[model samples]
Target: MSDKPYQDKAVIVTGASSGIGRALALRLADQGAWITLAARDAARLAVLAEECRQRGGKAIAVPTGVTGEAQCKALIERAVAEFGRLDVLINNAGIGATGLLEELPDLTLFKRVMDVNFYGVVYCTYYAVKHLKQTQGRIVNISSLGGKSPLPYNSNYNASKYAVHGFSDSVRMELAQAGVSVTLICPYWVVTEFHERLMDKDGTPRGPQGRAIYSEKTMTADQCAATTLKAAARRKREVLMGPGWLTVWLRIIAPGLVDKITIEMVLKPLVRRAEKTQSKE
Candidate 1:
């Protein structure tokens, strides 16, 4: 391995408009990586591309919504065409919803979350796998701690990440023989725009004003990006970031106990607040 492992590498970062994806792009750029910035926001992607260039990495903005298979294929093709090869693919695009499954107005919330979070990863990886094989590259999936354990009011989000967890793990085994590495990143609550994108019970985006229970102990997007980059560089199989790993272990040793703890420590407060907010409305 080289001291500057990412130097001159061709990397594609989905959801590059903001949050963890944006942070990852900038950090990769600083490492001299050729970055392909993909997001729904063309304006933001273009701006980020320029910033990457200023940091010494070549970059291209490929405006994309990962929900469509054709778009994902095109994204992979564009990155390979521009950079001559694909060294890394980061599946960081995701969305979330907050509410009990029974509370949602329709199943659209579940479908939408699955489409963006699970299918988006599937589409991008399916397209990029062959290219990555040629370069013996890396695939990084950004998941959540909620994926590993049950969290009330996040059934849709949890299901999506759970799908990602299983898919990524299975794919990693399949790609092991080809020298292509897959890394699953399960990070705890991070200070990002995720809360803004979180949907409420009525199938509407929560926006910035949405009331979310956040822990004072949180990691910044930059911190998450740095940690993820390190894990990907090392070709780690899976990593659990922050204290959230406890739930994963406890779930294994004492599933019922963990469930009770989760309900008491996290779910009850959320349900209480949701009820209060509803009463006012």
Candidate 2:
């Protein structure tokens, strides 16, 4: 669609059953890429694969739980076996939780968040690197704006994303010489099922706490997917999407000021509202 010539290329999209992952997979399919859709939801993956094929693209659904190393390895193996080569790997699968550090039980929530967000990216990158080195391909990691700027009540999520920024930057340096590119996509508050899945310390849903700060600025999954693919095509080191760009820049220019502002303007208010909502419920 971009006239950039992606026909017949092979791509692997993790968490491809829904949301941003699904949007990316379909976009690549439109570019005539052979897609390997990986997700834990086999049924949803199957439906997505069918949709891709219906659009006249080659696609296969591979059920994968990227939190496990073996599953990540199997996913790459299946992609290679099916497509013979891998051109791109989109590390998009992730989960989120909300609570204070003290509210969480030790590092359980932190570990779980990192396992899927950071470790899962690591596992997929490890396997994909071997193939990508051979093809001189690309890796696009779906990171959140939270990775660049800290967000209260979502410390675990922010930490995981920060780890991703560090990891991706290191890999990009290591792979630059090999002609294997790495791109990080940082998006802010896209309207997705992510909120519905957000959990508390007891694994209970964290429903709408208060009026969202960026409630009116929600970007669609398709818009995010398109921006991500464009970034990949350009081989950009980083792409910041949505209105969160200013916040990320502020963090770089004046960390303490932004930190104080974020705490005062966003975190405390949101926490109080959440507590009030929980009390009512």
lDDT of 2 by residue, 1-281 (tens): 35744578899999898889999888888878899999999999999999998876799999999899999999999999999999999999988887888877678778989999999999999989989999889999999998887788888899999999999999999999899999999998786677767778666764664224336567888999989988888889999877677987788899999889888998899789769978999
* Candidate number with greatest TM-score: 1
What's model 2's TM-score?
0.94
Error of 2 at 6 (Å): 2.5
CA displacement after TM-score superposition, residue 220 of candidate 1 (Å): 0.7
Stretches of candidate 2 above 4 Å error?
Answer: 1-4, 207-216
Clashes, model 2? 0
* Candidate 2 minimal-lDDT segment of 10 residues: 205-214
Q: 1-281 in candidate 1: lDDT tens per residue?
A: 66678999999999999999999999999999999999999999999999999999999999999999999999999999999999999999988888988877889879999999999999999999999999999999999997888688899999999999999989999999999999999998888888887888776777777425465667889999999999999999888988777878889999998888889988899899888988999
